[model samples]
Target: MTLPMQVPIPGLPARVRIHEVGPRDGLQNEKATVPTAVKADFVRRLAEAGLTTVEATSFVHPEWVPQLADAEELFPQVAALPVALPVLVPNERGLDRALALGARRVAVFASATESFAKANLNRTVDESLAMFAPVVARAKAAGVHVRGYLSMCFGDPWEGAVPVPRVVRVCRALLDLGCDELSLGDTIGVATPGHVTALLDELTGQGVPVDAVGVHFHDTYGQALANTLAALQRGVTTVDASAGGLGGCPFAKSATGNLATEDLVWMLRGLGVETGVDLDRLVATSVWMAAHLNRPSPSRTVRALSPTHHQEQ
Candidate 1:
């Protein structure tokens, strides 16, 4: 696919790996119960669009996230896809459900701020980490790759610009759990470039391998792409992006869509960075999803490139 435009960005990697989260993170916020088949097709289309790591679904309790209640049925449909399907497991029960359906990769989420931990997970920071310790271990022992997600790593709504050390503590605990990687999240989309650098610096000082780190940014303040560039310059390889810029934290009422995969791919392509994603197909998938939900996608790249993006009313 041809790129929309190009602008030189210094100190960027030649290639970046985008961990597609639209299927889970993006759709969970939607009130509509997306059909199980639609979710499966979304993942499959993401793979066809050249996204290798599509987060397929979450194994959270149905009461908590009704959209993902079909995890049991969802996994079997996409289990054989030639891509990494990592499901979010809130605890051992979630892991059990994932494992039963042949899930080979899983993710555990924790909050850097105590307030968010209490609000989102109904547990304190330590309690959440303690719960994940054995889940990570047993999952690893079962040969499943585990990823740790530390939310509010940059700034928390209740706490305001979070302290690096506080975020680091959660990161260390996750690392201790033998997580294959850590996906630091800017849950409120308040992070700036400086915060991104400082956090990565501190994480490195604490002996956390930079290579084992990824970033998840929200576009609430329209800083997701700028912050993404900051992380990329700091050697972060994995980035979490939602197709058509879909989804936000249910807890963060003010937050917006994630850094759009289309926008990121557009910027990376301009910098001559290889993502291996078919931008045209990716936008098409997002467009199809938007139609299903009776809305236009929020992605700038999708809007700019779509032939019928803004149809005459």
Candidate 2:
């Protein structure tokens, strides 16, 4: 019901494409199983709210993430949506599952540190990359878009601050493996604006195009927006966010929820950056999801704008 005054910022991209991760990354770690139909509706609502790219679900084994076990059943439900629906694929098997469902876009998760590699993927950093190489290649061969998710780019709970060179090396490897783009992740939310700038600078210096990069920051330290601003200032136009701030790393205890889409949209709107999203519709969608999850929305913008906020007050 309220909007921030438009104030254009110099040196930022004119338009940003938000890669909404609510249905998949957001709900993947829920303690209880979210019904398949509900998940499908969530994706539809998000698309209706003008989110052009919504990650639908992951094809990881059910044992690894029971919350997304319905990927098979869920993908078909929302596959007809006009927006881009990307699915996460752990390996070739996961990619196979996604391909079977005619998924056009898929993502592979990688860790920048060995500790997280072992903790999350049960492999060394190289080993995990090796496992993903074939999957990326096949996805590319199938004419499907691929996104590589590099986690713990800023700080790792087990390894402490990750080196810029180390992150760059893994990023280059993912790009070499045929990934169309990479989402740099601050899984623990420990990144500051300076850290974000340094990483982007290093990546750009190492020949990683800024336009091919996306940022995925968590809110553990309340720095998601700041970190995102840094990325935007560096010319990155793709950002990963979840509705209602609904996900955390199941493998990394220190990790928290991904950056909130409503929060990001609010900031972008104020900055006069076009995201092609309807702020009112987006807030309402998050509020409806919060009701389904039986928890208040963690996004400040969602809470401030939702009609229920006044009712509760």
Error of 1 at 19 (Å): 0.3
Deviation of model 2 at 38, angstroms: 0.2
Error of 1 at 77 (Å): 0.6
Clashes of each: 0, 0
Q: Best candidate per lDDT, number? A: 2
Q: Per the 3 Å backbone cut-off, how many clashing residue pairs does candidate 2 have?
A: 0
- What is the overall TM-score of model 1 with all chains considered together? 0.97
Give the clashing pairs for model 2: none
Model 2 residue runs over 4 Å out of place are 310-313
lDDT of 1: 0.91
Worst 10 residues of 1 by lDDT: 304-313
Q: Taking the tens digit of each residue's C-alpha lDDT, what string does model 1 give over 204-224?
A: 999999889999999988899
Candidate 2 local lDDT, residue 184: 97
lDDT per model vs. reference: 0.91, 0.93
